[model samples]
Target: MEPHAARPLEGRLALVTGAGQGVGRGIASCLAAAGATVAVNDLAPTRADAVAAEIRDAGGDAFGLAFDVTDADAAQTAVGDLEIDILVNNAGVPPGGGRPNRFAQMPPEDWQLQIDLNLAALMRLAQLVIPGQAERGWGRIIQISSGASSRGLAIGVAAYGAAKAGGEALIRHLGVEYGPEGITANSLALGLMEGVGRAGDPAVDRLIRGVPIGRLGRPQEVGEACVWLASEAGGLVNAQVIHLNGGTVFGR
Candidate 1:
């Protein structure tokens, strides 16, 4: 859709974390295309700037904001002056960068790292953005979670799953508490995406066979979903986890 063609998020500003590549980049691109001025964030300045430039090259408004979301001081400094109407908490990773480690074998430090990045950082960003949103009488908080969140105690990703579940739980509470204030909170529990889950890989192929869609999801699809949820049409939804897996799993 063209930016001038009845765009729902025109005049809004959105902050998308970890937006340098993959799913975050896709979300940022879509939000900009939907007429939202996007704050493209990444820990790396170059990556953030690149994505922002990509949006601008496509005729959308955007600017890069580089800061580690896990660093409270940095995050505050980066976002304190901006009036963000939408916050997309998409920065996260499992311990060892998604390498599998059993719960019993995982160290406490690893567990803390998982929580800090996956759960604590989310709350921190929400804290920074929600108050301004409340003052303005509108806001949207969207979490990019994993399918492991609702799967319940998976063998190799116990800590990661737990942290994601905690984030979802927090979203539910925020939805109920802030709904009257015109703020909506929800989570998009993802399955596998193109780069993240390749089709030719043996394990991914096995997983794809089980998926009713018979393919890995594209990042733009996730982006489109974020656009809808951030728009007025998705206002009725709150405190809910919308699964984006291709029928590989179901229900929150």
Candidate 2:
């Protein structure tokens, strides 16, 4: 990576949940590129270690922290005593369309799972990381959200939309409460990103067609936003959900 003026995050330690693959992997790499030592956290040890190794091989500093974010005990253990300056709460698992059936057909278990993975775990991390940020008088936390939080989403995904929206609101609440302490929290609202999970599904093509950019969003673009938000250069950026949906909201 070429040198730039805003090395605001150099020497900072960043812990990114869900750093196993896709957008999470991209964000971890972006933070590392900015000279931060990244803790690549993920539920899958193999994916987490692989991403961490990639960062190290690229001449960046990184280590893997493997655990399920939804597990409170595991979260405390994996993030035990971290005086981290940045946190990217990006771990999430899609319902895989099984729960996207009509509301009447949707299973209660699937809805609960979505809520647990996307919303519950994020709030837990905020609780875990805030005290340290408050003590430091300077820190950043960037939550990864979905564009569906504000706009319409896929069929039967009402629960996911609601949960993501709630998480964004939490980011705003923390941003306001901690701003005086020099800690800023923000969120990135994303749309259809290519090359990951159901993102490449044919059904998603219909969603992509609505994007003015005429293509799916890239993981790197979303990662860059997280990197900026976690850096000191973004000191004034707090409590905002910057949509990276490539104009897909034109119809919304």
Assess each prediction's global lDDT (C-alpha) against the native: 0.88, 0.82
* lDDT by residue (tens digit), candidate 1, 1-252: 223446788989999999998889999999999999999999889999999999999999999999998899999999999999999999986323665579889888888888999899999999999999999999999999988887764557888888999999999999999999999999999886777554478876776777799877778999999999999889999999999988877211
lDDT, residue 230, model 2: 76
RMSD to the true structure for each prediction, in A, is 2.6, 3.1
Residue 162, candidate 2: Cα error in Å is 0.8
**Model 2 — TM-score against the truth?**
0.91
Predicted candidate 2 versus true structure: per-residue lDDT over 1-252, tens digit per residue = 223565656778899988889889999999898888899998779999999999999989999999988889999987868878898988766524335655567788877877888899988988888898898787898988887689775566777777888899999999999999999999898877876337567767776777888888777887788877876667789989898888776211
Clashing pairs in 2: none
Query: TM-score of predicted model 1?
Result: 0.94
Task: Give each model a TM-score.
Answer: 0.94, 0.91
Model 1 CA deviation exceeding 4 Å by range: 1-5, 94-98, 153-155, 250-252
Distance (Å) between predicted and true CA of 31, model 1? 0.2
